[model samples]
Target: MTTEIHVTTLGHWSNSSAGPTTSFHLAADDAEVMLDVGVDPVGRLQAAGLSPTDVTHVYVSHLHSDHVGGFANFVFTRSLLNRAGDVPLLKLTIVGHPSVLAGLKELLRVQYPEREFDLAWVECGEEPVALGGQLTMRLVPTDHPVPCYGVVVETGRARIGFTADTGPVPSHQHDFAGCDVLIGEAFGLRGDVGESIHRRGHMTAEDLGELVAATRPKFVVPFHFGQEYADADKRAELLSACGAAEVTTVDPVDAKPVIIGG
Candidate 1:
């Protein structure tokens, strides 16, 4: 059996006409994982030719609305589908920091008090968590105003890293080192927005470039910017910053899967 991992960015912008927010769908062998349940995730998944029921795991980086606002909607949609006999209820495992999980649980309870879900919770810890088959994930703490975590997913044949929502955290270089693909946040251009970007706990293109330089990932996918950066010239500028670090930048706006292995 050949091992292949496909990473697709369902939503890439922080805020703008191009947003549902920051979300990604990763499929490998026996696992289908969602990096974040950004707003309108169900619609985004469907737009990407996928369904919420197909997801086996969801990893929440933080409790921010942009990252977790659609979580209840996803769960509710799945439950409704199962109730309507459109699909069978599958146990969905949610991986996140304890606080994040708690917040999600409360959100679900408040949003759907009349329903029950086949859900499992896993708290992010220092140890890597296996996601069945040959896939395993390690959640590393990231620098953010609120509790947030970056994730590294390893298949037998490939390793993918996600920086989540963060500022320039030097320690993350060691955690994301040797990744085949690194999906990083490029919220803006360095100095273009001054210290506001860092103050918000988000990285600029230059910050992401520094990370790419340190990690040396084979491919760096930049996302989580506004619509302004979606323009061809601005996009190129963003790519130039990261690419100058000697790493290839895969534009997440293309909505194409970045395939690894096989």
Candidate 2:
């Protein structure tokens, strides 16, 4: 069987960025998954030519505002579409850490007391789990100030690794070995304060470069760029340090989805 992974970058910045926040759309055949539903994810989804209802599974790496702030919006929008009586409510499966899911439920309950949305929440751990009937997913703990995880998605032929938002978790490299594409964050450029960056639970350009060098993914897609490193040169400098043969930086110039097959 041939499996295809289609990854679209909806937004590529941390919460602080003036632009849309970081989010990714990963799809394999008929299964559509959202990597992280950042603030205004619905708008970002539309911008990327995707509908909110098209998302079947959502895998959140952490509970930061940039990652889950738009959870209610996504649910509400999808609910509205269902209420219009034009289509059935799309079943949304939310996967996240136990505590994160708990907090999310409370947040939703508090915000929309009168209305209930059609969705299911799955609290995930470090164990590998099967998703969408074909993809295999595993969450590995990452080096962040708060509890966070790096997601690994694999099919029979290819694997995609997402660092989410982390400083450095060298042991996690083992989980990402030989991935077809590795999406890592570059929160700051080389001259930034290493301690400060790590303290904020983010990675500097050098940090991501080191990670790519260690993991050796076939392709590296750097996103979640800090304001100072928004320029392509800054991103290029980071990739140069990675010493990888193929590195891709997604920007306005090239907003097309990256396709990987297995």
Candidate 3:
């Protein structure tokens, strides 16, 4: 049961990067799961040859425009496609804290004045979410200004852990241990004010290096790059710092989409 995890970069790091976002597509043979739908995620899905209708579950990291920018679009697409009877309105499960969900509702009212949903919100205080088959998500708190949660997502044989936005490594680093792949946030490069000046909403490249040092995942995918450094150098620096993990940076648009158990 070797599970496969596919990652697609819906959001990449560029000088004029409109949305500081990334979309992950993790699937197992037949089941499909989308993680962190943000900043034109629906458009990114389309660009990756997928539809919002294909997404079964969406696991959010934290409540930031970059992370959740595509929520309204995803919801709007789903609502437009599923007309209360179109294919039974695919069960879209959003995993996050209760307050985070609340904040989203407030955001929706402002973002999409004519938006509604026939979905379920899983406020993962402690209980994990079973995404129908071959997939489950367990949440762990991360170091962010607001209440944020990282995810330990397991689908068949592949386990992908994500640290959305963290100041540095999570204190509970052991929680996401033994994952096949880990996608950590590297907002800014080392020696840059990305560490010293940011309001703790994002992290610096050095901070992600700490994540690699603390958690030894097989592959470390560095994402959420700030407009300060080239992703290539940032990845190299992070990998060199880890010394044990294979680090890869995902280009939100060009990176391959992960298809599990295929």
Candidate 4:
């Protein structure tokens, strides 16, 4: 009865990186979900061998540009493709906090006033949202300057947790507990500088390590790193901190699918 969930980090680096921001693609039980749109999500999705038309749902964690900058493009591209007869216009569901959804809708209206797309908007809250088939998702509030949320997606046999972006919040330990795979943010290394970032609503490697120890997910994937941390040595240092918690740590590779479960 084990379910295999395939997760691909479409974009792992933070805004500082001259690359894609933060986005993840999760394929489970016939559900194709994107954790965040980030910038150029459509391009990244194509590079990962996934067609935009195949995506069933997109979950936005917050309103940060880095996390949702590409949403307009995604919608516009889909509409354009349908108009070109390249694909049929399918209804796409977008889930996010009410505020985030409102803002994104306005953004689309402002960006493309003439185009109308097939999109269903769902506001995420404490209730578990049914995502077709046996898949369901629950949203948890995170500690950030702006309103943000983390998500836990359940696929019958496995639960996948994603900490979109946030500072150290103790409640997360319980929120993400028992997840088969937990994708947490480790924005920086442990040090004085890291402490500053932590206070600004971002987790450092040490913070993520502590969470891993407490939540004890079967597998932990760390991401949302600054460009400097992308260096091999710095990346190793961050992984070591998480490994110290005696849990398996997986480094997210852009566009590479990491299979979770048996």
Candidate 5:
């Protein structure tokens, strides 16, 4: 089983680059899975050379537009691209917290009132959903203002934990314990953050550092940046803080897809 993680970033700490916001393109050799459909997503994913026909699943992090805003376009694109004879349109599943169904669904219907495809709305709760091949995923509740979740993608060889939009509660991260790759959001200035910031659920670099120590991930990829920082130094600290453990930096926009386990 092989998995490819292509990250076409839109907006980051400072810039949006060529992509939309923070959507991810996770492809498992035979199947395609998209995480989050943030604003301008189809354009971004297409820009990355991937078409809607290739995507089979979409797991959203939250109700934020930047996360699930492109649901309609994704469906529309699939409708246009996968109309080959004898083959059904790609099956699309949209997963998200149950609390966000009204908002995300309303947006979807608004864009495509004629809902015209094989789509299923799975309110991601406790069941382990199979993502084809050797990949399986589970969405866990994270500490955010509204209902939000971080994804845990596991393969036979390794496991990857992605903290979408979370605060500092670390309680939700326990499921990620001992993962091979931990992708955490680093979205704030350390000393500069006001007292009210941490309470908002977006993890600061410091909070992520603490999480890395507690969770004991072999590798840490810090994502989601703050507007004030230009360098990756803040995210780099996860290396020193973790005592010689390997650390890789994922810029808001990276050209090549990252493969966790070869």
Candidate 6:
């Protein structure tokens, strides 16, 4: 069973990248899933040679606009883009925390009073939910300003962890222990900016580096970078702090899929 992970969008909210906001697409033998749906998620999927129906499940970390702004568009396309007859649209399941689930429904209800899609919402707790026979995922609370979670996805062959918009939390290392790939967020460098400037919201590059070093994932792909850590030199410095590990830096605009196992 092979696994393909694509970084659809590679920037934070304030980034000027050509593509949409930060999102990830995970394609495995068991299930096709999306990590987040940022702005222009449909466009991002098109760029990745996929359609709206290709994504069966979406795991939303939080209710930030940069992360879930494209959710309405995604549901609308999947609901209406199908055959205009008796054929039903594809079933799209959205998984998130209890708080996120409530906000999500209200967010969509405001735009779409008459819900036409066969959408399902699942609330994730401490227990892991089996999306497929070989795919299982669990959400762990992270240190963010709002209620946010860092997702851990485990496949038959590899385990992938995504630290979505989190501050320095030592427990995350244990949460995502022994992952094959860790997709972390580095908004900026820690020492570069004043320590007080980055507190409780996003992780700095240095902070992520230390976290990665503790977990020691096989590959570290950092995203959600800010202007301070956007340069190649700055990114390299961040990767260097992770000790000796394979680092694949995703481009801010367009990037090819990074296959973890085959």
In model 6, the Cα lDDT at residue 101 comes to 86
lDDT of 1 by residue, 66-126 (tens): 8888999998887676576655667899998788899999999999998888899987775
For model 4, the local distance difference test gives 0.84
Total clashing pairs for each candidate:
0, 1, 8, 0, 7, 0
Top TM-score hit? 1
Instruction: Give the distance in Å from residue 216's predicted Cα in candidate 4 to where it truly belongs.
Output: 1.2
Q: After superposition, which runs of candidate 6 have C-alpha atoms over 4 Å from their true positions? A: 1-19, 84-88, 228-230, 239-243, 246-254
lDDT of 5 at 8: 40
Candidate 4: residue 149 lDDT (0-100): 95
Candidate 1 stretches greater than 4 Å from native: 16-18, 83-87, 244-246
The count of backbone overlaps in candidate 1 is 0
In model 5, where is the ten-residue run with the lowest total lDDT? 10-19
Q: Evaluate model 2: give its lDDT.
A: 0.76
How much lDDT does each candidate structure score? 0.86, 0.76, 0.67, 0.84, 0.66, 0.74
In model 6, how large is the Cα lDDT of residue 27?
A: 77
Q: Model 3: per-residue lDDT, tens digit, 31-61? A: 6667677677777777778777878777777
Model 4 agreement with the true structure over 75-154: per-residue lDDT tens digits: 88866665666556668899988988998899899998988877899887878888778888899888889999999998
TM-score for each of the candidates: 0.94, 0.90, 0.82, 0.93, 0.82, 0.88
Q: Using alpha carbons, what is the TM-score of model 3?
A: 0.82
Backbone clash pairs for candidate 1 read none
In candidate 4, which residue ranges exceed 4 Å CA deviation? 1-3, 82-87, 244-246
lDDT tens digits, residues 1-262, model 5?
Answer: 3444444443343225523466667665565677677666677777778877777777778776666766677777767775664677667777766777667677767887877556777766656677557767888778778778888866556677778888777474587787776767776646656446668778766777778777877666666664444444743453333222455545443445556544
Best by lDDT: 1
Instruction: Give all candidate RMSDs, comma-separated.
Output: 1.8, 2.4, 3.4, 2.1, 3.3, 2.7
